[model samples]
Target: MHLKDIIWMGGLLTVLSFPVSATEIEWPVYGGDNLHQRHSKLTQITKNNVSGLVEAWEFDTGINATFQATPVVQDGVMYVSLPFNDVVALDAASGKQLWRYEHDLDEDYPICCGPANRGVAVSNGMVFTGTIDARLIALDAKTGEKRWDNRVVGDNTGIREEVSRLDDSELGSVSGTSGAGINMAPMIYQDTVIIGITGVGYGLHLDATDSDSPLGAVVGIAGKYGRRGFMAGYDMKTGKQKWQFDTIKSKNWEGDFVTKTADGVELPRDIAKERASLEKYSDAWRYGGASAWSTPVIDPYTGILHFGTGNPSPQMEGSSRPGDNLYSSSLLALDANSGDYRWHYQQVPHDSWGYDVASPPVLFEITIKGKPIPAIGQAGKTGWFYVHDRRNGKFLYKSEAFVPQKNMFELPTSEGTIIYPGVMGGANWSPVSVDARRRLVFIAAIHWPVEYKLHQQPARNGEAAIRYSSMSPLNTPEKHGLLTAIDLDNGEIVWQVKTENPLIGGVLSTASGLVFTGEGRGELMAFDADSGEKRWSGKTEAGVNAPPITYSINGKQHIAVAVGGNRLFGFKTGQKIKVWRLP
Candidate 1:
């Protein structure tokens, strides 16, 4: 049977087993459903009537930070997390506030990125959120009262001490140093809440001087600074630890020192030099930075969970940490119940370009040679849409470049090298939308190029010599966005639409033949899913740098999104959740 038929039968079985109200459709999961499709089946608002959409209601969160949460709805109640990890439950039909939970963060902890919480997960009358201070808390879904709070990690003073010992010049143009925290929405499977850590990858972020401009740069310094990252599951009832899977393996973390990607793309590596120095950094896995940047998507039938990992420590200068860096920059599969490793596919071996598998993976079925194969797709920062067999993590194929590509996988030089789809990505941590029946995947991508320059400083004042690299996106008029549709069957670009600013958030597609996405320029847009034609645009008070979600209440369709701008990209930040519907 086709994947669409499987999905339809699954929904039918769900409805037969548990009677659901026909008038109410809830977006219960972060990515619409367990498959992480981000595609809605609602069709009340069609292409012809989409232009008639107007603001139905709006609720201000009273927080002005990088708001990136994708709101979740269930049983006529909407749950969303603010940039500071505070969560509020709102009435789905009206904008009335039901209750709020104020997250108490530790003021002394070092935060790698600015205050940004992707969202919350609701299950079994409990609302779960990962805080900026690296703690996971569960709140009573109805009363917003805290039930339990579990600290994921201890004080990160060791990382801070290592960073402090580095020379000032070796740190490069830095706005912030690396630290540990949680940024992704928690994923619940059965009785476990799964989440991962971020900012463990040693790098320095440069903030834009102008509050309305994009980021300044991302610098990678060579040193032993960050701790290993991991994803762990916790008991739902008591918040007790269940199982943990470290992104960097404890044994043989270096692997076979392959000179190319698993899919056969050659990389620029000094294998001889790395092999000779393996013993020098044999214990690098302790500080090997493979931060988990996004949430995991599971296959219910097989009990396998798939997710992405971030870059290795010391970021772009990989001299100290050699070899393939094991699980960093790779797609990982694990047994959902036990956290046992199943398989992995590294996209960048011995990576030094900051190409992290930061986007969430989408699961579906594809027919190959008349046999239905479980497939997974991830929108990569390296300007490609990669497809793989979900069951065993086998690379199937990669789509045509969705954005411009130049000097890819090239080593940095003192004179600097220009690369497209730089650190900000062809796709960042944004979730993608998939239309299974249409065999198309929608992507919201960025088209910014960066000048990759290497810096070397000699020893001074009894300090050791240091080397690092700085990646600065060219502040040119050409930086923009691309909303692309790629054919899943053949891995081809079906259509693309360009925007004035680089896309930062995500995309949402509906069965009504409409695609929705937000822009950094304060506009939410809809397009013809088949042709990529703009159908409607609505102005917002702040940058709509978050994914748009659609659902129905009382048989009436509505669209909603978080309207706070991203601070790292320097968009206009605000504190509002806007809902719209056709009039």
Candidate 2:
């Protein structure tokens, strides 16, 4: 096998030179491996036998909340994180609980979205998880006992006060106020466990009036409301800070004011006005919001970490922050060892449309123009799967819009501008799966259109007038979901499937030529990877609003996923991890 076929399992480089037995197959990372491919090599559950899969076991976390964890398995133990950041060790074969570590959150700790932890990272006999209170914790892999706890950030006084002062009436009916927290699964690179902070790109998320409906709106009030976000590395054993990379650049944030994207998509910008007001908000980067929304994929050969950044702060209204936001709404590459900036590809410059590059990036080798190149792909909220040269961040090509996109990059007007793949995203924090051998990328995406409206309120209570913007899904279009497979070689949709509701979680691809993903209606469905044929479907008690992972224990293959629904999208919430296998 070639060097490109080597897989990094929990920071150790292992070459896939020969076929390993099914018993040795285990999901050791959030995306199945360090490449974040989310592909399993075990073939016991082939397409022919997938329809016969039956429930093998189910484990309830007992804390019903928005569960989005992707369980990691190694040896015979499955390590999973709960909605409240609690860690649990389970017997992978029977879903039997071995040990549990309850996370003790600070009573006054600030939370943005509900307690939704993506998952945990296990390395060197320790399980690492980032808490909703901005703390990094390490637990013994054997007994689930605490090893070390490090606070990623100490001061949240400013953000807490700002959130407290937010007027609900002015912001509409919000479900939660944005505050700093850590929700992403930590990534282990060598001896350092990497994680990032979220909610720094503060925006008030409105709640849907109907309990079963999707989100209502995301309101962005114009002011200094958030602090800069960062992704840092810490020692896995001691939880000591190694280095930090700020998402927003303090200086030279205003890049070349390009009127269009690299692909020639025109942007609506007041370049003249922005240049004139540049000096006024000169210190804007201090509070600039570009929250790290997902786990990064590292190029083991190059030692470069690739990840995405969220929308700029004060969210939708960007008048106060001038020029192209350097790092926000972009794909960034940094040195994994030193945390030094390598390159960045900004998808939306000075973005006011809330088009965050929120999806976790996937790395693979692609042949471009007869030359094999190390490439990285990120499914963007802008509705395009962006492919770039992973080594130097070169724009290669982007897949056709998987979801319907109308009036993209349009600035909000007082009357309201309608846009598909709005704040909720074309591909939110969901991770994509890649079948390197087939050159296909599977993505779970949303097709909900939202109305972007600008609001200007009159001066009241001795305060000055306030201007803001809001995004809410439009009822007329009717929200839905799309599971798309894009050919990496040609950047075209190979196959696509539609679902009744928006797909929020992630995707799993298997060597059995099967693709698995969940729906908001609580069904785990599998599809033929080559053709968009629905092969099988399994119903769950709650919405399967998390990624599915496949592993083999005792030579028996099993598929598992966290079954708690997402609160932001108003999916039916529960507390269960369901596993299935061919009986």
Candidate 3:
């Protein structure tokens, strides 16, 4: 009964007006609200009964590999989060573990993406998480007990964090690697949780200055005594740090660009990488492309705080630095109480194909030519679906619909807009659903043209060396992965449903017309949000890449998922969370 006394008695019964219950069973966070739009206006589980459903329970976290989080639930309880940073709490109708905190991780942090944790941020009774060994714990949401552990990026930062600390025969440097952290799922926003660090900077960029990416941040801790990251506030009741935002724009650029050292000699920076302990304090911390990695859409009706930025690294190339790099892959619109900015919408301006707008923008409200406005519609991977105007970022379109585009600047007009659903567009990171009472919105896509193969590796005693670029072989074939259907009054797309193993998981629509999803092939189906047909299926022995939730509990109505392991196969079904319900 304490989520601030249930939001102060649901805002005092909506100001003595009563109403407001709207089906009470919660899915709580991740994309259920804070406007992530993995929408769910509760439809009593539809598609004419989702094929009579089944399963109702399955748990086995036998410690597999990459279980992309997303379980959350509350009141009835269920928290999940495992991949290396482990965190457990279950009882949402009998899964029973009730508390398991496992966190010792030290195989030598290399992580491009593996020990991924993504799920757990409950607040009030506690239950926070973020650690690939980078730290940010917080438990006890009913006795998981630990209450605080904020390390927030600390393997040591100063004396080169003690010379990258690796004694004992240099301990093979970080053997088998388990070392890096945070894969997503941390947005409390009021007691200040914020998080956003999925990599890139761990190698540093303005030619990588050193220490393991201090230039790729978004921090903001403070739940109850553990002060961390850039530090600012939280002394209130004692979570520590009250304010801080670092971005000092520094550069190295490996002498603007020129390398040839496999044996030749042109050394500049990344001698062998890992440097960035929050150095530049000013040029706004410009080291290279931004890295906010999805999950940020606050808008309690515009107290405004949106997010989505990435791919400005050496991963792909916009030649080098160039303009339009402001705030990195752009979409920011801060002021969530001083993170400032307020209005940006670049969606791949100089982007280069590591396509940044990492997905999950969803904020809702439709209408275009007739202008109903109030939008925030994202769906990117640089393949495009943009939609802006979340109170003033406007792009309701006079043009802005891109694909296979190429204006390369120098334009009096068309400089960028060709975006044929390239980097897994229409949706990626699985999560797109909005019923708004059946006005409809349900995404799922992946159409190919991955393209991006830059490469650079020779900055020896000075800096800049570990470039990391390779991706352009996702030929999913069969027309590639769509689920489309747009027309929230006129942006037009209206009917799509083309799949062949390319939906990328996370979607659930109801009002009883059904549209559940989770299938990169581990099945878990049901369609027909209005003629997409197909109606029922189930498999999930693995690969559905998380994101699918629906509830009811005592009255029945299930349908959940999280088949585990992602970043394209990591956790391997061994980490499970599967539900179905109907009987």
- Candidate 1's error at 483, in angstroms? 0.5
RMSD of each: 3.8, 4.5, 22.4
Worst 10 residues of 3 by lDDT: 218-227
Supply the TM-score for candidate 3. 0.31
* Tens digits of per-residue lDDT for model 3, 1-583: 2112223564574323332242235688887666666655555667677777888788887786556678888777778888777788887776677778877775655544446566877877788777765566777788887767766655532111111212122112221111234567777777676665555423212212222221121111101111111211122123444544331123432222223211132322332221231222122123443555556768886677777766544334332343333445556666665565567666544344455666667777776677677787766654446676787786664112322333221111112233334444535666577776567666776664433333334566666453333333334353356777565544556667776666665676766777777665577777888888888988777777667787666766576777863534211354688888887
**How many clashes in each structure?**
0, 0, 49
* lDDT score for residue 360 of model 2: 95
Give me the runs in candidate 1 sitting further than 4 Å from their true place: 1-24, 155-176, 207-214
Structural RMSD, model 2: 4.5
Candidate 2 lDDT, 1-583, residue by residue in tens: 2223777899999866665743338898887877889988778998898999999999989988888999999888999999878999999999899999998888686666568899998889999999888999999999999999988987652252243333545455553345788889999899999999988877666554432245567787766767888999998778889999999998888888889987789988889999999999898777788989888888879889998998888788788888887899999999999899999999999888888888999999888678999999999998899999898999999999999988888888888888877887899889999999888999999988888888777777787776777887776647899999999887899989999989999999998899999987899999999998999999998899999999988778899999999877768999999999999
Task: Rate residue 191 of model 1 by lDDT.
Answer: 99
For every model shown, what is its TM-score relative to the native structure?
0.94, 0.94, 0.31
Local accuracy of candidate 1 as per-residue lDDT tens digits, 463-521: 77767678888888888999999999888999999999989889999988999999988
Best by lDDT: 1
Candidate 2 error regions (>4 Å)? 1-24, 156-178, 207-214
